[model samples]
Target: MAPVPVAEGIFTWPSDEPQLIGSRCTSCQIVTFPVQASCPRCASTKMEAHLLARRGRLWAWTTQEFPPPSPPYAGPTGDAFVPFGVGYVELGGEVRVETRLTVADPEALTEGMEMELVLVPFRADEDGDEVMTFAFRPAD
Candidate 1:
């Protein structure tokens, strides 16, 4: 089956180097992820699609020890669930993006460590197609 993105418009897909799709305010130059209609700083409506940096520094991190609550959480559960890492990565010193980490060990992750964007398997769709999602991993 074909692979598909977890959601639409979150990041560029079907590319060798995928980038997160964000918005930049033409008024204040403030950047936001997931694309915003208006600027948060000056409240300007002049926002444009901005492709965020693919590499960044890990600002902070934590482990998802338990499965997230249902209704919105659609991944594995019970014995099938695995603990994973989640963190905020500051990209190009412009914006901090909350993302899943490829590394899950707390002893391995450190603040200010270099991280690069990657695509990982998120879940399977109803038709059994693999769903892909964006994540960050330690840069060599």
Candidate 2:
């Protein structure tokens, strides 16, 4: 089964080094991921699509030892619970994203470590097709 993106219009697909397609406020210089419809600070509608830096620095990180409440998190739970890393990654002074970290081992991460954007398997849909999502990992 083909891997499907978690959502559309977030990142370029089928890429070795993909960039997060975000939005930039024309009124101000603020940038946001997931392409905000309007600037959060200024509430201006003059937002434009902007490609984010693929590489970033790990600002901070932590691990999820248990499954999140199932209503929002559609991934596996209970026995299938897999500990994962969650963190903030700053993209070249553009923006900081709170996202899933590809590295599960906390010991492998460090403050200001170089990180690169990547696609990783998230979950399987009802049809058993793999659902993929963007993540960050130690840069090569």
Candidate 3:
């Protein structure tokens, strides 16, 4: 898998599952990933980056195993990504984030089930380097 370039001081992947660690404005209490200079809700510049939870509940999902047409992916060309579940997950005390589901069987996936984040190889680069990507796995 190719190496995915991550901007410095932008986001941190504490666990295998990457969470969009960001700061929330104390004035308006708006959550922004990457610790914005100013709050979008209250336009306050005071904010701090905080680590989020690693588990959430699946709100919805859809499989799209087809290889992405976007860049940074150089695996088997035209190879489908294999139908994997992708949907919104509500993190406890955090926010509802959209992510892909990491389940072997799509039919077994159900809404409202507990899910955990997992880091997996996204794709291989030209040098055969594995690009690590995070996905939400069903815990139930």
Q: Which has the greatest TM-score?
A: 1
Lowest lDDT block of 10, candidate 2:
11-20
Q: What is the lDDT of residue 25 in candidate 3?
A: 84
Count the clashes in each prediction. Answer: 0, 0, 16
TM-score to native of every candidate shown: 0.98, 0.95, 0.73
Q: Candidate 3 regions off by >4 Å?
A: 1-20, 71-76, 104-106
lDDT of 2: 0.90
Arranged by lDDT, best first: 1, 2, 3
Give residue 105's lDDT in candidate 1 (0 to 100): 97
- Expressed as tens digits, the lDDT of each residue in 73-108 for candidate 3 is 544455445556678778765567777677747678
Candidate 2, pairs of clashing residues? none
Q: Cα lDDT of all candidates, in order?
A: 0.95, 0.90, 0.67
Candidate 2 deviant stretches above 4 angstroms? none
Show the lowest summed lDDT stretch of 10 residues, model 1: 70-79
RMSD of 3: 3.5
| CA deviation > 4 Å runs, candidate 1 | none
lDDT of 2 by residue, 22-60 (tens): 899999979998898999999999999999998889998
